[model samples]
Each structure stands twice: as structure tokens, then as C-alpha cells.
Target: MHLSGSPTRPPRSRMPRALRTLGNPLEWTDIQKTILIFFPPIPFTLFYLYRVNGLLADPTVEPYISRPALATTHSFLVGILSAFSGLFVLWFVLRRREGTHDLFVRAVIHSWFVLMGLGAYLVGPFSTPVLIGYQAGGMAVFLLFDVRRAAQGGLVGLLVIVGTTILERAGLLLYGPVFSSVVFAGERPPDVWVYLNLAFTVVLTAAVLAGTGLAMALARARQEEINELLATDVLTGLANRRGLEDMLEREITRAQRFDAPLAVVMLDLDHFKRVNDTHGHRAGDAVLQAVGEVVASHLREVDAAGRYGGEELLLVLPEAELSGARAAAERVCAAIRALVVEHDEHALRVTASAGCAALVPGQPRSGEQLVRAADAALYRAKERGRDRVEVETDPAP
Candidate 1:
């Protein structure tokens, strides 16, 4: 024997703030951006390798104390390190965990910077001061902890490449002039510093621009979604009254200008109150939603269906004559009466009535007149018996 009493507690159902933020609609777009982050590094590494090889092929090119083999080795190691950093990006894609992906990407980018500093140790030291300035500027912009963190990341990345070139040259400089004589044997190879500056400038600029474009696209997408939510009915996913009115006015103007037929159909669920009282409000809601689906499915793509009010729907059919509109409205009524939705393991059926009015040529058929004519015909359908379609004819044309 069990005793029944009021429940002691309310249901504990709620999502935490952190989880909500993480599951924000924009999160997937950020994931899409991750694919682009790894692209610039590939070309950047290749360009750096090109600089290293350009020096190595020259007979005068020398590594720390005329060690040509060490210079080549340094170039190979830098390429390998850059390639490794790029490969780690794939892991981030596969993982697809936002927090972990951000953390890993940051670590890889920072580590790449550190390697650039190490690469400078292999090549000959700086000749012009501009090259050093390039490295410093890149390091400052990309690695700087500011609001534009990704821009900073790219900047740091470019600087790291320049740093790598500088590190190798600086290494040769500290070692001796023989190292310089070997690397710069006959003529300087267009100052590796110039190449470094160009690489950082071009790559970092592109990265920042690309990030900005992606951010703009995300914002645009959000605006479009908000507009749709405001204009669409949540239950039926059709245009709301405001949206319907706007569209109707536009279609009416176009039809009048072109002398094309425009039709309006106002539909209401018949005996809707009886259904709600007999079953439940849930069942009535189901009936309304199912009728909406049925009506939409029967209509052509050119026609617009909107939820006008409680248990009432409106259809705007352009380039359709009175006959065509009436036939379409009749079909919609039949479809709604045929619709049976399952509720609480029982099949429930409902009926709807429609009233259609068409704009005739040489008549001032405003949107208000068309809708009102349809509404009056809809009342006639209800009077003559529900679940039938009525058309307004003999209008003062």
C-alpha cells in the first residue's frame, strides 16, 4: 500500500553556464576556421627552406666556421621542425574538442617560435639592421598578448621564421669571419634578412585579413538567423503575420503592375474548440501543427503560407486565377481533414475550412480587400457546414 502526497522537490533540469557557452551556435564555425590556420605555415616553411638552400649551394656559403655540412643540416632540421608543427594541426582536427584544440594549437604555434630562435644559431649572423628589426617587429605583433590573439599568433609565427634565419647568421657571426666567407663567398645572396622580412610581412598580413573575413561572415550569419526567427512562426515554421503582410503587399503590387492574377486564401480549423475540450490542449496543438504541414505540402513553391492567428492560416498565391486558387484551397481543405496525427497512442483527425479570393484585372484590389473577402467567405464555409472551401465571387469589379 503506497500513500500519495505532494512532491517534495521540483525537477532539477538545467544546463550550466559554461556548458551553454561551449555549446554556443557559433562554436562549429570556429571549428571550420581551424582548418585554415595550418595553411600559411606550409608555404612559409618552404620559403625559409629556399633561403637556406640558396646559401648552401654557394661555394662561399659557410656554416659556423666554414662548416657547409652544418649549414645544410640546420636547414634540413628547420624544415623538419616546421613540417612537424603543421602535422600536429591534423590531430587538432581529429580531436575536435574545442578546449583541447585551442590549447594544442597555441602550444604548437609557440613551440614553432622557439624553433625559429634556435634556427638562427645555424645560419650566418645579420648584415643589415633592417633584418633584425623585421624579426623584432614580427615577434612583437604575433606573440603579443592582446585582444587579437590569433593575429598575434600569426605575427609571432612570421617573426619566428625571421628569427630562425637570424639565429643561423648570428651563429656564424659569433663563430668567425671564415664562416661568413664560406656562406657569403663571392656575393651576398640578396641578404637572407630581406627574404625573412618579406616572408613575415606577406604571411602575417594575409593571416590577419583572413581571420577578419571569417569573423565578418560569422556575424552576418548570426544576423540572418535573428531576422528569420523574428519573421517565422516557431510552431509551424511558416511566415508569421508580419512577414505574411509584407510579402502579400509586395506580391500584390507586382501583380497589379504586371496585370497578373493574385489570390489569397484564409483557412481556419473547423470545430477546433470542440477538439480541445474533448481531448486536451496538447491534442489541439498537434492538430494545428499537422494541418499546417498538410496545407504546406499541397502548395506550390511560389505560394507563401503563414500562420495568421490561432487555428487560422493565410496563403498568398501569385499568378494564380480564381479557379486555380479555389481548387488549391479545396485540396488544402481535403488534406487537412485527411490528416491524422498520433497522440498518446491514439490516432486523432481534424478538419479545416478555407475561403479564397482572387484579384481581377481593372479592379482596385488592395491587400486588405482580398484578405477581408477571403475571411467573409471563410465564415460562409463554417455556416454551410465546416471542412469545406468557399470562394468569393461577384465582387464589385
Candidate 2:
């Protein structure tokens, strides 16, 4: 049965879907929805590589660019294309093999960032706008990969750009290495820098487009983080009541649309008032927080947990039936009985009673009705000597 994930950590599947800024392009982070090695679509990368190849290949493009620069750019493009082609061929041959795609996914994408930086530097002088390549490519890396990989890739990539500019300034390497006779004034290219300007402008345009896309992605991620923070409970680190109600409504809609099963579990602490009376409110708060953690940890990635109220929690399971919901509540009750929260150097113990309710397709029941049923079952658990599990199978409001 499907269940939503806990509060602190969202499901991996949901994380990727939430990043729908690029039309869900290139789930490079996860192997399941993985795209072509470095780029999302194969044609997009091929077109980008070939476009650069054409710029360097045409003598009219750079207007009498040097032989060394010509050969160097040609060789670089050839190598990049060949490497990508070989991988595609390998993937095709082993297409039917079970983990073949996994091997291809390890394709060193960030390394290409450094290579792009080096390549962009070669085509223009130190003052050329192509320098934006580092920033553009770095942002893309930061978004596509995780933090550690992003930092590592970005560090080396920036070093390549900065190191090359330093070398050119020191006369150790030729500025405008790709344009043989291209010379620059202190802060800008010289008057005879017409053709070089054209080439650099093209590179700048590409960088601008890439940077803009990455910036939008950054905004989307940040907004999502802010939204999650607002939804979370300050004390329990679980979804607050509002968040739970929102999730319940959404789950109910999904269940209705897809004819899927839906379940809710309402759990309340037994003798919670007694704990506060004996240990004080601060310690009682600690107990609630600890219990919330336990509940969040016990559920699957598809299970949703939230703080319903003081000493009470709710769980929303997407594809669970009445029996599954009942069993899940029982497991939760057992876990609570075994839990120990240490506050003020004292080992405080607590027990929980839980009630479950579920829905079938075309049940004509609302999420509120489902919650009320679970609440009724929870009251029954309390009446039947507490610290137990109960279920309400009837969908009637």
C-alpha cells in the first residue's frame, strides 16, 4: 500500500516533481528519470556542441583565425562529440541489460564544466564577455548536482577560468589565443577586434540564456523551501494542523480522481495531562516532540505525518485500506509504548491510542468525514482502557 513520507524529509519522487520549473527536464539527480549524460535532451546538447563547432570551423566567423586555434578547436569538438557518441553506442548495445543505464549515468557531467570554461577562454581575449561561461556553467552545476559535487565542480571550474586569465595577463599565455593577431587594450579589445567581438557576443548570448534558466531554477527551489518552513510545526518538527488539512484535501482529491484507496490514522497520547502535571509543561513538550519524531520515522516515504493538536498526531496513507490502516496504527501504538523520553535526567515513558479510517473508490465521502471517523475510533480507543488501536470501516459521515 502507498503512504506519503514523513514531515522532515519529503519523498525523493516528490522532490523531483516539485522541481517542475524546466518542464520536469533532466532528472539527472535520480537515475530513474535520468537524461542524456551532461544535458537533459540529446538533441539540445548536440545542437549546442555543433553550434560552437560551426563558429570555430568557419573562417568567415573569426575572419582569418590562426591555424593552431583552428586545429585546437576542431580537435576539442571532435573529442567531445566522439566521447558522447561512444557512450550512446555503448548504452544502445547494452540497452536490454538490467543496470546498463546506471553505468552511463555516472558520466562525469561536472568535469565538462571545467572543459567548457577552458574552451570558452581559448576563443576570446581575457576581457571578452565569454568569461560569463564560468558563472553560467557553475549555476547549472549547482542546481543539477548536490551541494558537495556542486562545490567541487564549481571550485575547479572557476579556477580554470581565473587561472587562464591570470596567465594571459602575465604574458605567460597569449590573450585571444584563438585569434592569432587579436590584440586588446588594457580594459578592452583593440579597434581591429570586430570579428572577435561577433564570436564573443554569440558565446555571451548562450551564457546569458543558460544563466537565466538556472536563476529561475534557484528561485523555484528557494520558494519551495520557504513554503515547507511555513507548513512545519515549530515544536514537533512535523506538519502543523493547517498543513495536515491541506494534505488531506489533496490526498482525497487524488484518491477520488484515480479511484485509489485512502486512509487516515488519529493518535492521541494516553494520560498526557498527567505527564504535564508531574514533569511540568517543558518536559511534556519534550515528550510530544520525541513522539512526533518516532511517528515520522515509523511511516513509509508515501505516508504523511502531522501534529494534529497537543499530544495528538495524524497520518495520511494514500493507497491503504481499512486493514492496512488498522495494522499501521497498532504498530505505532506498540512503538509509543516502547519509547522513552529523557527530560530533567528522568526517563519519562508514554503510551498512545490510535484509530484508523479508510475509503474505497466512489465512496462519496469527503476527507473531513474520513477524519471524523478516525477521531471517533480514537475516542473508542480511549474508552476501551486507552493504549490501543481501533478502526472505523464505515464511510458514512
Candidate 3:
């Protein structure tokens, strides 16, 4: 069965030691991207503010009206306000769990680009090339997302550029008097210089896109490795206890929503401590691994099998009634008993006891309650002598 949740909050105490040393990778990556999205404009805004202050301090440096310093000041303030406001909104949404991190990241990046593009347009053509380059670099950052999302961002950026260009051209045609006074006062650079600048921007964008793509691929690969380590039992290659908890929670919700049958089987190797005392710990590990494989082989595709701690495993069977769960538990017990693990040239055979519990209609129980019932039955199976399956007794009305 498939398990889904926010990657940011993976199960605790299940991650590999190495991964733990690095902290939550998803959260770290999210923070980094958020900073990249919101922090880059601060320096530029500060620089413009500094320049505006200088211009006001001494008008001889450049006439305020001619230099469009006031317009630059306004754009810088708007950018700072937009960045902070967006950051606060995103942080609030994340805290509320109302949206995905990636979704918020995309929104922030897109809005930043749109605002920057508008600012560039307002500042007129002399500054457009440099700002356009910055916009391209911002587009390259979309690589932090998946290929499809990156492509979507790229398309949106292209549309914004085209639309802004068209509007600028149209303004020149329809409102020449007003547009010329605002945007065309500065002496335009040579055509060669403009084209050269555009070419440099394109080349820089391509290089950044390639680098970002590589970095994203590496990050994704590392995340997959870490996820594997977190979810799997090192000894048995089965789902670990934390993974089982996650799966159980999801299955519980699904069953409750659909009013479907669900069962939990708690299995424990009998006389496991004795086995370890008789044989070495390695032999005990081998036996546990064999049992894990046997249990997995006996389960259906919709069933989940996991290691629920030392010498103990759990099975979650969705859409399985009491009888079906009993049968499955019995089968698992038989399979585990039949398992043979060869250690130190000795064929060691092991047996397991299992307890089965199923959800009953009209009786509401949480996933933990189901597991507790199964565990109680498991105790009974142990008391009844190992290598058997016991179903939890149903409560009377």
C-alpha cells in the first residue's frame, strides 16, 4: 500500500544516524529556497535606497527629476514590502499546514519575478537589460522544483516578458507624449551594446539553469536515499516501526472514511531470547530476516508488513475481515515456522506466534486500539505455547 504525507515531517527516530546528523533534509532545503526567494532583493533595495539618499543629500550628483531616482526609490520600497509580506504570508500558511511548501515557493518566486519585471519596465530601457538578466537568473532557480514545475515557471516568465514588451510598445504607439516623457528621457545605449547585453543574459541564464538542474538532481537522489534508510528495517528490508506507524495511520483514515474492514496482526518470534542465547546474535538476526521475508511473501499487495521492533513484526490488512485476518495470521505463523536459516553450518528453525484483530462496524476504535487488541491476543498466543495464531475476542453489546 502507498503511504503519503508531508516529507518535511518524516517519522521520528527512524532516520539513519548519518541522515540525522544532517537534520531534516526537506526542511533544510525548504528554508534555503525560501531565503533564496526572498533575501536576494534586500541588498538591491538597500543599494537603491542608499543611492536615493545620496541624490537627495546632493542634487549636484545628478538632478533628481532627470535621473528617475524617485522612481527607483519607490520601486525599491515596493520590492521590500512585497518580499516581507509574501514571506510572512508563506510562513503563516506553512505553520497552519494549509498549503504545500512547494506551492508556496512557486507563488513567491512567480510574484517576485512579476514585481521585478514591472519595476524594470518602470525604470525604462536603460536598466531593462540588467534587470532582465536578474529575472532570467530567478527563472533558473525554478530548477529547485521538478521538471514540470520548472517548465511551467519558465513558460510563465516568458509570457510575462512578452506581455510587458507588448505593453511597452503599445504605450509608445498610443500614448507617445506621456510614455516618452517618463521612459525615454535617458539617452538610449547603442543597438550593439543592447544586443550584446541580451546575449550575455541568455548565456548566463543557460549556464545557471544547467547548474541548478544538476544540483536539483543530486538533491533528489540524496533525499531518496535518506527516505529509504528512514522507512526500512536494516536487518529485514521490511518497513520499520516508524514506517508502520505512518502506514497504519493512513490505512485507519481510509478504512474509517469508506467504512471498510481493516485488520492488524501482531507477530512475535517465540523464545527469541533463548534462540539468541543458544545461537549467536547473528543467527538470531538471520532468523528474524527470514521471518520478515516469509511474512512478506504470504501477504497480499494491499497488505503491509513491517518490523515493529526486536523479534516483533506487524501486518496491516485493509479490507480484511476477522476470519480473513485469522487465516492470514495462521498462514504467516506456518510460513515463519517453516523458515530455515543456516548459520555456522547449522540449520536453525524458528516459529512465531501471531494475534489478529479486525475492525467491527458500529464500534469505533482508533488504530492504536486495534493494535492493542491484537497485542493482547498475541500475549494469549504466547501463553498458549508458540507457533499458533489467536484472534482477538469481540466485545459483547
Best by TM-score: 1
Q: Give lDDT tens digits, candidate 2, residues 317-357.
A: 98999899988888888887988877777788889999999
Two-way TM-score contest, 1 vs 2, winner: 1
**Per-candidate count of clashing residue pairs (backbone under 3 Å):** 21, 6, 0
* TM-score for each candidate, following the candidate numbering: 0.58, 0.53, 0.54
lDDT of 1 at 333: 81
User: Which candidate comes out best when scored by lDDT?
Assistant: 2
When summed lDDT is taken over every stretch of 10 residues in candidate 3, the lowest stretch is: 1-10
RMSD of each: 10.6, 14.8, 14.8
What's the TM for model 1? 0.58
TM-score of model 2 vs. true structure: 0.53
Q: How far is candidate 2 from the true structure (C-alpha RMSD, Å)?
A: 14.8
Error of 1 at 244 (Å): 2.0
Q: lDDT per prediction?
A: 0.65, 0.71, 0.68
* Model 1 CA lDDT for position 55: 56
